[model samples]
Structure formats: structure tokens, C-alpha cells
Target: MASSAFSAAKIVGLTGAAWLSGTIAAISLISIPAVSRTLKEDNLSAAHAVKLWRNNFEAGFALAPPIALATASSLASCGWAARNLRTSGVKDGRLFWVAAALTVSIVPYTIIFMKSTNDKLLRYAKKEKLTTSESQETEGLLKRWVFLNSVRSLLPLAGALLTSIVVLA
Candidate 1:
């Protein structure tokens, strides 16, 4: 029963981490470019762009935390099981622990590094009408957000990579 539970946890942890990382990466690589192009259209107002950003943000906000927590829990369970099963004196679960830590760190990463950009985006988004200058500023802000978000996505990817290594070994 313990072995089966550990195996399930490993599968769940690895798959969840990979899925989270890939989804975020897709937003950065595919969705953002499409949004940028759409916003460049002369027919769309700044408000429209902001609305699109908000929709994306809300979706991601809803999705990320639960997945992160679940993945981290599974990784921690795998680590605990690994530690218990080890016969050697050396530490057994360090890789799994690190993987779990990296997976869960995205929350703080967003709060610390991505908050200012998010706030600025939200502040600008709330306006019914942006000055031409403010509209231009949104473009720059979006670019900054995309860059930071791309970096943020790496945390889970790294965790998934670590998990893969640990599991395969």
C-alpha cells in the first residue's frame, strides 16, 4: 500500500508540475504574441486590451495556486516515502524536497517580482479611457509583464525536470 501510494504521488506530482509549466509557457509564447497582435489593430481600444489581459490574468490566478499546492503535496509525499524506505545513512529525499520547494515557490515569486507589473496593469486597465500616452505605456507594460511571467514559468519547469531526474534514477 505504501509503495502504491508513493508511486501514485510520483506520477501525480510529475504530471501536475509538467502541465503547470507547459500551460504557463504556452501563455507566454503563444497567447501573449496573439494578444499583442490583436491589440495592435486600429479598431481595438486600450480598454479592450486591458480587458483581454484581465481575462487571462483571472484564468491563470484561478488555476495556478491549486495546481501548485497539489503538486507540492504529492512531491512532499514522495519525499517522505523515499526517506522512510532508504537503507543508507545519507539523505534520500533531498531532490524531491528541492523539487517540491521549487514547485511551490511560484506563489512568492509572483507576489514579490510580478506584483508591481500586475498592479500597474490593473491600474491602467481600470480606466475607461486612456490618454494616447497611457495607451502607449500599456504596450511597454505588457512587454515587461510577459518577460517577467516567462521567467516565473521556469520555476515549475525546473521542478519538473528535477522530479523527472529523481524518479528515473
Candidate 2:
């Protein structure tokens, strides 16, 4: 039987992973699409689109990394405790470590995969006057970001799924 502390950590880690995944999914599915609609349907200005994107980015930046670190930390703790506390032949918490790795992998994924799109968007946001081509490119960049973020969201969700299987097993 797992100790109370290990049980608590498992709960925390699993919940955190689920929450993180859901949050990112919401941003990709709901928030970004709405902002994109502002550009197309509403015929809003580039500055308005950039402002909305910046708002979402700032909020996500403030929220996501800390949650990732906390979830990964909790998962790592569960892994350590499970490894040390095993008494008989049973599945250990090694998967928890993998979950931790997946949950935190979003950091590098963002830095590597999403950085170029993010940089381009930021550059566009800063420009005082966008050329007609640059304005057209904004839509493409936003679409690319949505796709990248959708992929990034899967990482934490996979972590959460792995954690769930291990716990239920």
C-alpha cells in the first residue's frame, strides 16, 4: 500500500498535469481562434490582433511554466517515494518519472519548436507600419502558432495519461 504522502503527491501531480493540458488546449482551441476571427471576421486592425495575442501570451507565460515545474516536481517526488517504498513485486512508479519528463518537456518544445513563430509574431507586433505582405503573413503566423501550441498541449496530456494508467494499475 502506498503511504499517505505518496498518495497525496500522486493526486497533486495528476491533477496538475490534467489542468496544465486543459489550459493549453483551451488557449489553442478557444482563445487563439477567437483572436484570429478578430482579424478575419471582424476586420480588426493588426495592432488589435497583436494586443490580444500579447494579452494571451502574457497570461500564459505567467501561468504555464510555474504549473509545469510544480507538476513535474510532484511527479518526481512520487517516483522517488514509490521506488523507495516498494515492498513486493508490483509495478513501480518509474512511469511517474516519465510523466515528469513529459510534463516539463513543453519548456524545451516551446523554446525550440515555437520560438521562431513567436519571434516573428513579436517582431510584427513591434512594427509601426506593416507592409501588405506582412499583414497577410500575420494570419499565417497565428495559424502556425495555434498548430504548434496544439501539439505542445499534448505533452502534458500524455503525462497525465501515463500517470493515470500507473495509478490505476
Candidate 3:
């Protein structure tokens, strides 16, 4: 095992990736039924449905900045590690991305998962507040996000598998 800080960061990051990926994948898989349940009739008047669409869109929009930040941090960390191989900070290459992704995803992922409270989203929710009613309306949207996150989980696992094959074969 690496030193305490190093290992802890790695574990925190990897755990976040696994969780984010799993939840994203689950969301992506189950989004359709959610839509159907919400609008029994396919045809939604613009005024009636706009709020719902925007709410979900707001959820995604909320996520975008964090995703951008997380990706940037991971990529930047990887680049720095590559330049300074002797340092005891983050290691080089995808490991850096993975670790950074994990460490960074914590708050954003938590915000999405912990629908029990909307204080975070509500703080930013425009127009009407993030009422408890929003949870039911937004579950599918959040689920889709989680499903996409699953793909992220799979990527690191794939990288590790390939590395193992090369070393042990």
C-alpha cells in the first residue's frame, strides 16, 4: 500500500468512480420508464411541459460545470505527474485521471444522489424553489446521469485489465 494520504486519495477517488459509474449506468438504463410514467400522453403542451423539461435540464446544467471541473483537474493532474515522475504526488497517466475523478466527483455525485434534501439544488433553483415535488419529476433525469456515470466506472476497470494482461501474460 502507498502512504496514508496517497492511498486514501486513491481509494476515495476509485470508490467515487465506482459509485458514480454504477449510479450513472443505472440511471441511463431506467430513464425511459420514468418519462412514460410522468406524461401519460406523449403530447405535452409547451407551457405545461416546459417547467418539467427545464427542471431536468437545470439538473443537467448543474452537473455540467462540475463535470468540466472534474475532467480538467484529472487531466491536469495527469499531465503534471507526467512531467514530475520523481514526485510523491499523483502518479502519471490514467491513474491520475482516475484518482482525480474520484476525489472530485464526491460533492457533485452526492448532490445528485441525496435527493432527500434539495438545499444545494434549491439554493440555485430558479423561479420556484426545489420543492419535494421535484424529486418525483426529476428521478428519471438523475437516473440517466447515473447510467452515464457507469460507463466511467467501466473505463478504469478496462484499463486495469489491459495493464494486468500485459504484465502477467
Pairs in clash, predicted candidate 2: none
Worst 10 residues of 2 by lDDT: 82-91
Model 3 lDDT at residue 48: 34
Task: Give the TM-scores of the predictions, in the order they appear.
Answer: 0.93, 0.93, 0.39
The reply for model 2, stretches above 4 Å from the true place, is 87-90
The model with the greatest lDDT is 2
Clashing pairs in 1: none
- Clash pairs detected, candidate 3: 13-102, 21-149, 21-150, 23-146, 24-146, 24-147, 25-146, 25-147, 27-143, 28-147
lDDT of 1 by residue, 34-146 (tens): 77778886567777787788778888989988999999999988887787765322147788888898988889999999999899888877889899998888888888888
Candidates ranked by TM-score: 2, 1, 3
Compose the digit string of candidate 3's lDDT tens values, residues 32-96: 34443454556432233335444654564476446535543534444444435434443444545
Count of steric clashes across candidates, in order: 0, 0, 10
lDDT, model 2, position 53: 81
